[model samples]
Target chain A: MPGINTSSLPDIIFMLLFFFMVSTTMREVTVRVKQRMPEATEVQKLEKKSLVSFIYIGEPKNTKLFGTKSRIQLNDVFASVDDIPEFIAKEREARDEADRKFITTSLKVDGNTKMGIVTDVKQELRKSGAFKINYSTRKKVERRSR
Target chain B: MARRAAPEINAGSTADIAFLLLIFFLVTTTMDVDTGITRKLPPPVENPDEDVDVKERNVLKILVNSHDMLMVDGKRSDVRLLKDKTKDFMALHPDNPDYPEITTKFIEELGKEFPASKGVISLKNDRGTSYEMYIKVQNELARAFNEMKDERSVELFGVKYSQLVDENKIKAINKLVPVRISEAEPEDIGGK
Candidate 1:
């Protein structure tokens, strides 16, 4: 018996692999801040990927490099509150006019973080009219029944 | 047709090219999934000094200090009991002749005050308060509204709040007990 030709094996695997790549979103940034999200029972899954921008707040992941300070991360850059409006404006411009109204700012903050920076971030977002804010959290784990 | 056999095309190189591209994308693809709790921030007021006065009776004040302790309506409260207390405060059918959800019999049973239409939840926290505690309180308040909406949904439409697809039905449920959370500016307890 002759051996079967398997020349198209890689092609078959690539097609499936490509589908997975295209179907899922790529991680856009490396988080330099350490974040442990809080848990909430009323969590909602954000439906649209396009209309959301992320803001990460926590202590520096490399505590030695940034001195264990809580920092604000917008995209790949560490930013101050002054940069928030410009960031949101840029984000808004990337969206279609019709979809702009639905744009959301997702806040991923460490549970142990103080509210000082979070409050400032919220104020800046409000000034930018990025009123749709999502607090990233985990679903409440059921520990007991009534 | 034996003399016209189709020319054999090579597919060997195509596999290598695909393999390279596949590896690139496979490594770049992110498996991290993100989900969250969404809140709409009220548009900022022009003047911080200009404010409307709310009756003390119609407001439930929740203060989270630096210690992550909860003060609900001036009383110290456990994080766990926040939900039930919020639910009790949000109870609509506690015997109001006007709302009818608060039937006299219902009020007689539960012994709750007549639910107020103009009730507001004022959430204030010290800057030193942990985000964890803040989020938990928010979750409880949101759950209070959600549970009411869900209960009303079941009574009216025999479905869960999320399953009520009609916009009008949703509006009606919301009108029953409008979500009126007022988050106050945090006090600078972090000393920043």
Candidate 2:
């Protein structure tokens, strides 16, 4: 009889809802680069555990450029074109030896960086003797107004 | 027909469930962030057209290990020598129709070397390389190439800088130079 009592049902329902709501948390995906990226309407989902290489260019800590601390992010530097293939081979070997069946290598470039750097990264990755390479991207999630 | 007036069930309970589901998705899903460098890839084909002839011998291959070390044609060199040595190589391959930028005679001449010698740069960036350094390299190459294109337009075609790049032409310019990057598999490369 006590269990079946219906008078306090509304309070029980409210308490259950509150408990469920407080218990849930959001998940986060951490990418390598720390910068504001340019967004694309179309995004490609990359393979999991694949190879993704990041380049950063900025002033070394405590260095002054033009009398002011010249802060250049990693995206500003250039990778020698000649070194690309060997780099790819090394990457391939490392991935294969680790027992990974499939690998996708990607580059996370800077927005302020010039187009040449992006091109060099791509050129090197392709010629690295690896057959397939993936460029990393993020999907545009619709923002909900608070 | 004695009667059956079925009681009307409340619809409000269903609304409560829907509200809970909406809130759950709102809290659990990740927020999207902005990214740079939109790379439009070649169509995925069941079998791609095999890359023919075009001697791979002259192609200078640079390898970046996961440690970010620079390796050129299997030989190690200081980073400072990269641009100068690339320029020298371009000079050797004169009149190679594939890479027009090679004739520029400047550090920018390296971009021509990439495409002309059927140049293939193989980046073997390690998994641990920071994203910041990766992009910095990419941007530097882009700037170098753009300078080459600008110089070539002025030297070879006598086109003014204004004609080369304009507000209306900027979008098209982005398509002119295609950066070729390939990621090699760990297994095929011997897993070093």
Could you give candidate 2's per-residue lDDT for residues B1-192 as a string of tens digits? 788989988755654665566567556644433243334333333444565343454455555544556676679864545555444443336665443233222124223322233344344554344343444344334334445455545664466333754543343333333345433332223232
lDDT of 2 by residue, A1-146 (tens): 35654545555566655665555443323332334443332344553433443433222333342232222322233335565666556656766576432555445443333333444555455554443444343444645553
Report the Cα lDDT for residue B127, model 2: 39
Superposed model 2: Cα runs more than 4 Å off: A1-146, B1-38, B42-54, B84-92, B95-117, B157-192
The digit string of per-residue lDDT tens for model 1 on B51-158 reads: 777667567789998888999988999978887877776565444432223322223322333343556788999888889989989988888888878987897679
Residue A89 CA displacement from its true place in model 1, Å: 1.7
What's the TM-score of chain A alone for every prediction? 0.87, 0.48
lDDT of 1 at A132: 94
Worst 10 residues of 2 chain A by lDDT: A66-75
Q: Which candidate is the best by TM-score?
A: 1
Q: Residue by residue across A51-118, what tens digits does model 1's lDDT show?
A: 88999999988888888778999899899989999999999999999999999899999998988789
